[model samples]
Target: MRECIRCGEQMKEGCAIRVEGSATGIIMSTKENAMFSGRIGYPKVAICPKCGEVSIYVENVEKLK
Candidate 1:
């Protein structure tokens, strides 16, 4: 059961949120920069309907390594 950190209310599983590298689509670094390379994450989300708070859950953090 996910709980809203901000409002302390029960949260309901909502959707999958896509997370990407911070430099995505930004041509500020060298072509070889790993920061600009594509890295993605799909984390399940939970939301508190009453307070409109959101939470993200990543099943495997090693995938980001």
Candidate 2:
């Protein structure tokens, strides 16, 4: 359980949200050049139902590399 930073209320652990890197325009959309381009990151999130606040953090930053 996590605490809401704004409302000081106990927050509930939500689902794992998938996060991916993005680029603007037509830079690159194919997976072939993804290695030299964007990166992948997965962050665990917690939500406060009382205040509707959200908090996101990466449990293992090393995994992003």
Candidate 3:
């Protein structure tokens, strides 16, 4: 479970961060050349309902290493 940084509240996880007019979500990579790198994963988002704090994270963190 994710916690809010600003307020002491449990955040809503498993959210997607997509472009304004696109269906594609944000991606994160460990290597500079993300296209050719296998160490890339979609980022998950967490939002705090209390303080409106947003946090972005990768669920498959092992892939980044």
Q: Could you estimate the TM-score for every candidate?
A: 0.49, 0.50, 0.80
Among the numbered candidates, top lDDT falls to 3
Which lDDT values do the candidates have, in the order given? 0.62, 0.63, 0.81
Judged by whole-model lDDT over C-alpha atoms, candidate 2 comes out at 0.63
lDDT of 1 at 55: 79
TM-score of 1: 0.49
The whole-model C-alpha lDDT of candidate 1 against the native structure comes to 0.62
Q: Estimate, for each residue in 1-65, the C-alpha lDDT of model 3 and write its tens digit.
A: 88898987999999888899887656666776765576567778899999899998888877755
Q: For each candidate, how many residue pairs have backbone atoms clashing (under 3 Å)?
A: 0, 0, 0
The best candidate in terms of TM-score: 3
The ten-residue window of minimal lDDT in model 3 covers 31-40
True-structure Cα RMSD, model 1: 7.1
lDDT of 2 by residue, 1-53 (tens): 67899999998785455435754222222245673445334457788889988
Q: Give the range where candidate 2 is weakest over 10 consecutive residues by summed lDDT.
A: 22-31
Please estimate how well model 3 matches the true structure, expressed as its whole-model Cα lDDT: 0.81
Which whole-number lDDT from 0 to 100 does residue 56 have in model 1? 70
